[model samples]
Target: MPGYHSFTANIIYNLAQLGIPIRDSEFFDIQTYLEIVEIHKNVYAGETPSRQATQADIDTFLG
Candidate 1:
């Protein structure tokens, strides 16, 4: 867990870049953290389909 905070910060930064807002409290929540990780995985993937799917997911999550 040495680089855990750094890793989560990177994920939060990426999400912010994508217009997703994350609260400081949510950072330590296992479910929310996992959800963010899953979203980040798809959004940052090299495949077009994955990106497209993640975009839809982001839209839904935000709405």
Candidate 2:
């Protein structure tokens, strides 16, 4: 986890704050759901532009 940012961790924390359920699984379904929710939250935060990263951006970084 050396290079990992806290983005996903923060999403999980926020989900907990909103009374959403979380569970650990081999497929990580809950974490995936929360990540999308977090992205939407950032996108619709009422700004002139959105800072939510695109899938291509993520793909570039992943590559």
Candidate 3:
């Protein structure tokens, strides 16, 4: 089964597709992680497993 790191890998991969470069360390940093979680919640809404993020979501997070 896919675990936490795999999940985070998915996040990183998707973000990179949007030209939003992110470091592995940033995912563990409280501030950056919280921002990512917030943007994630907003993007996925009620989706349980959290879908792969889109460029629009990344743009929103960038703003």
Candidate 4:
């Protein structure tokens, strides 16, 4: 939780550089990020980025 504020700040800065206006509300809430990261972690489990983790893997992990 302590470092998460930095993540949100970086997201805001990146979007702002693209001329996309963002409020703090636009950043993912902690719960949402946790959900998404859980999904991503499952997707990437037992694979490196070069390996292209699959939906099947995600489903398996979710299961």
Clashes of each: 0, 0, 0, 0
Q: What digit string (tens of lDDT, one per residue) describes model 4 on residues 1-63?
A: 999999878756655644555664367665764565566567667685576669998899999
Ranking by lDDT: 1, 3, 2, 4
What is candidate 3's lDDT per residue for 11-62, written digit by digit as tens? 7776665446675545466577558667865877666785799999999999
Whose lDDT is greatest here?
1
Can you give the TM-score per candidate against the true fold? 0.35, 0.30, 0.32, 0.35
User: In model 1, which residue pairs have backbone atoms overlapping below 3 Å?
Assistant: none
Q: Which of the two candidates, 2 or 4, achieves a greater lDDT against the reference?
A: 2
Candidate 3: which stretches are off by over 4 Å?
Answer: 23-63
Q: Of models 3 and 4, which has the larger TM-score?
A: 4
> For model 2, how does the per-residue alpha-carbon lDDT over 1-63 read when each residue is reduced to its tens digit?
853568667756766765566653234576676686777778667667757999998999999
Q: Model 2 — which ten-residue stretch has the worst lDDT?
A: 18-27
**Model 2 stretches with alpha carbons more than 4 Å out:** 1-3, 24-63
* Cand. 3 Cα-lDDT: 0.70
Which model is ahead, 1 or 3, in terms of lDDT? 1
Runs of candidate 4 with Cα error greater than 4 angstroms are 23-63
